[model samples]
Target: MEQKAAAKAKAPKRSQFSGMSKALVRRETISAYLFLLPSLFFFVGFVVVPMFICLIYSFFNMGLDSTSTTFAGLSNYVRMFQDPVFIRGFWNTVLIVVVSVPAVTAFSLWVSSAIYQMKPAVRSFFRCVFYLPVVTGSVAVTVVWKWMFNPYNGLLNQMFNTVGFDWLGNTKTAIWCIIMILFTTSIGQPIVLYVAALGNVDQSLVEAAQVDGATKLQVFWKIKWPQIMPTTLYILIITTINSFQCFALIQLLTSGGPSNSTSTIMYYIFYMVYRYNDFGYANAMGVVLAIIIAIFSAIQFKVTKTDN
Candidate 1:
């Protein structure tokens, strides 16, 4: 009887402890949810829900004044393959990446090396100068470049004509002008990134190499280059991404050019959305673009991956 009485008392005590633990766990869960609530709400509202909508839209022919969606099941993708304009846009974008990424990487690396080796104030001023295009108003920069590219009496054409080369006036030279503008203007971000990577490198190691009679070039090649390889890889990835987003400059400067030479994937997407009333196709293109970005990013991660 006494043992049974103790067992009954223990049962109630254990139940009370378990109930308190459950309540405490419930409180912790609620707190965690509370902390994440705003971000979660925004993600769903702005990103997740729209992403689903886009995915579904991609499978249908959703258009303005035609809320009715027709099942197309890869026809849009099929159309994309058949689209000469889209193909040209794709090649143009790829061409920009092929030419601009390397040039931008090289120039930004040079600028970063020079600036990093200078006095702090001088470094700041030059870095600021490079980034001025990005900061000192994007619209004004676009406007200036547009005027510089005018076919009749632009600065570029005038200079080229002076040199007996009508660059802006010639079809072969016009796309290249677009590429140059993109590369030059977007140098800011890469330079900043390179400078950051350069700052993190061990100065003592570099100096030790110099003390060992290593040439400046040797020191940079041996010690500095390997260290900043990650930065180079990073810039490559970002440059590719930004090259596509350079549609703003295209829209402002070329408007897809004298013969659609400057129409990028993003620019095409914009035209589809605004001009063609083709929301489904635009959404499909968006999904494709997103996939391309994700693939490139994954490739970058693989290429730049550290053993650890």
Candidate 2:
């Protein structure tokens, strides 16, 4: 009877402390949300509001400067299918993605692998060199490239006088020129990421594989590849999106020129908005671009998951 009475006395004390802990947890949660409220307000005001506006405006025919609007229904979306320029732009965008993604991923991997084992000074130097193109603003890079690609007096043509190739003027070479520049800019971040990922790979596993007489290639493929898959997936998705949104280079370099041969979806969107003043059509194009990017990202995640 004494033991039972003592147990009941302790139970009440425990319950009292538990209730206090619950109240404290609630207070901390409320404080955290309060801290987040300002940033959330700005995010909603700038990003969310604009996205909703774009969605709503995409259903109506609107002009850049005019106050009037007409309900467009699906006409803007329907017209995109019939637009020859949009089709060509889409195909060009696809070509850019197809060519750039693998090239960027592979080249970055190779460079990162090479530099990852070097002395710290050497690795840092190479990293900075490869990343220079990215930090130098896109406008500046494109301008320098423009100067280099000049057919008459550009440095590239000066060296290849006999071949006499018009790097940016010829339709066959214009897109590739853009790709080459895009590549220089794209690999910088991937290299940094890859170096980080490679550095974090468990040394014990690599040492074990070596002790087992595994070749360097075998060790990398077996032990390292799976660990770095997440970083690889991230690189792939970002590279794809960057390739899709390749606008400044096209705008400053070719302007979708030589019969729209180099036009991309982004370039076409700009053309529709500024050149044609079709706000609704441009918004529809923007929406479509977002959807396409989402689809591509989904497919990449699915394929990577299956491979894993």
Q: Report clashes for each candidate as comma-separated counts.
A: 0, 0
Q: Please report the TM-score between candidate 1 and the true structure.
A: 0.83
Model 1: lowest-lDDT 10 consecutive positions = 162-171
Could you tell me every candidate's TM-score relative to the true structure?
0.83, 0.91
| Clash list (residue pairs), candidate 1 | none
The clash tally of candidate 1 reads 0
Most lDDT-accurate candidate: 2
> Which structure among the candidates has the greatest TM-score?
2
C-alpha lDDT of candidate 1 relative to the true structure: 0.82
lDDT of each: 0.82, 0.91
